[model samples]
Target: MADELKRRLVHSSGAGLVALYLLADYFELGLTWPRFQVLMVVLAVGTIGLEFLRLQVGLDWQIYDKLTRDYEQDQFAGYGYYMVSMTVAVLLFDPQIALPAMLMLAIGDPISGAVSDDSLKFVKGPKVLVTMFVVSAIIAAPFLFEYPLAVLAAALGATIADGIKVRIGDYIVDDNLTIPIYASLLAWVVIEFVPV
Candidate 1:
């Protein structure tokens, strides 16, 4: 239960990035795209540094080791993946593509995990996909009002990406990295050509 709570807390915090960006826009907080991009890059750098330390020290700074199985292994962790994905979205894509991309993974993945499959392995459940698409589309509605096709594509792409976890040699590519990138690419493509 604690693990679940912690997972959701971290997930929600990531989703809150969307709110942060939106609030910054509404209040004219001077968070230009370049500034936000630089902030994300700095964050990624810090996270990578901490990951290196975590690899060397092993549990010295692992406060959540007891919470989730994700932290149990002696390897690079998902928090870094999550941070990198979010950073890449903001840095590489426009706000139209980036914000929903972040939210799709941030909000959609946890919902998929809670009801779909909790196993480390990838499992594509039809109900899970549906749930993810619906939730993501709803979450993205406000931002993607002008592009229905792009909205659906983003939701579908993220959900599908979440269903597949890949392993390259010794490393595990968690959905945390894939979903945002895939969704952003899919949505950006759709928006670019769909006469929106």
Candidate 2:
């Protein structure tokens, strides 16, 4: 499959599964803050595992390579970061908040990458990514958490930080920076707000 299509499938599938799982679990087990926490950990582990398998087996490396070029190595690093952030969010935030943030990472990040690669270019810095972040925040807010504004703000903030760290730095920023950072920030926001 094309990298863009693959990414879309991966992200949408992963996020959809997480959302479905959360909804089912909530209804079945009686929704609580702790359950949401557990869900985030579970989703992170599962998503990371799937991504690891895909990368290690070279299942999608060709497309990934073409899309990322020299920055492919950083993609693996991103996976680790994503796992850590998701775990933290689960431990710290409400599921309602965390899940939407996860969705942003899961759905928005990849979609943005695909869009940027095929349609938009970052000639003027991370403008494309920043725009993607804003759109993602707006879309994700209504579905993911009660404090949509706060979530959107957090997403925008993360976008800025990522733009600086990855797009504007002298050092190599790696192509994998987009999705991981986006997801991590969402996870962080979710964790921060989850009832403790």
User: What number of clashing residue pairs does each candidate have, in the order they appear?
Assistant: 0, 3
Q: What is the TM-score of each candidate against the true structure?
A: 0.90, 0.58
Per-residue lDDT of 60-123 in model 2, one digit per residue for the tens?
A: 6554564333444545544445555655645655555456555665666565555454532333
lDDT of 2 at 80: 46
Task: Put down candidate 1 lDDT per residue, 1-196, tens digits, no spaces.
Answer: 7778687678767877778778998999997878888888898889878878777776365575743355535666677888899899898889988898888888888887778756665567788778888888887677787899988888877977887667799666778888889888888889888786
Q: List the residue pairs that clash in candidate 1.
A: none
Residue-level error in angstroms, candidate 1, position 9: 1.5
All candidates' lDDT scores?
0.80, 0.55
**Model 2 lDDT on a 0 to 1 scale:** 0.55
Residue runs of model 2 more than 4 Å from their true location after superposition: 29-32, 42-77, 118-127, 143-148, 167-196
lDDT of 1 at 86: 89
